[model samples]
Target: MQQNKNDLQTTNKTKDSERIPAIRMFNLEDESSAFEIGSIPILMPTDATSFWASNKTEDWEQKMHPAPRKQYVVTIKGKLKFTVSDGSTFILEPGIILLAEDTIGEGHSWEIIDGNEWIRLYIPLSADADDHFIAENIG
Candidate 1:
């Protein structure tokens, strides 16, 4: 019975480890950018230029465009379907963490879906720092 219990524990651990979400990072250098899965724990905010929360509902079939700056876009409620310039598409649901790095050239576009209102928090990345380094260090 003890051996069976140990086996079950191991199986559960394996399943949990496999369930990590792949974060999508829109990159300026490579529109063919791939998703990054890092080991970073939830980080406490250190320094930020500014942050804001808004509830919006837009008719969002926007053309492919880069973000004005590097930022962290968290979907607090509602969902959006995002298609990066490289042809990768992801559904941005509530609780999704999007590291928006495609600040130049063709970036990404989105269509608002799900609900009449979407709430989000936006935090711009530091001018002196880059997303990859921050992600690596935090993890």
Candidate 2:
């Protein structure tokens, strides 16, 4: 019985380690922003102050700028191509979560890759909340 319990515990631990689809834009040591192909936990409880949705300008192409604050960006419509300071790029869509933490330095930019309009939600996290981001096993 104890052996079975231990096996179950190990299985649960493995399940918890599985990550969901996510992308992280973070400030690097040189004070420039970069992109990481990573994931947040399967279920992360975040403390957020508020959330708001927006449809950005017609241009739909942003120049380099940092995020206003640490937040989660959920794209509900339109596909986007995000480029960081290092010229690394990633495509994002409705099913992926954007962990925007590059609040300083030259951050990142994005352009609409699919439709004309890009609509998204910004959820600003509390100052002490955990982001639960993990960068590993992207290959």
**TM-score winner:** 2
Clashes of each: 0, 0
**lDDT of each residue in 1-139, candidate 2, tens digit only:** 2568889999978875676768989898998998787778776688997999999563423888888889999889999999999898999999788999998998888888898888899999888889888786645
Q: List the residue pairs that clash in candidate 1.
A: none
TM-score of each: 0.66, 0.81
lDDT of 1 by residue, 18-124 (tens): 44332546564455433443422344443468889978544442677777777777788887877876787878776556777667667778777887667889888
* RMSD from true fold, candidate 1: 5.7
Every candidate's lDDT = 0.64, 0.86
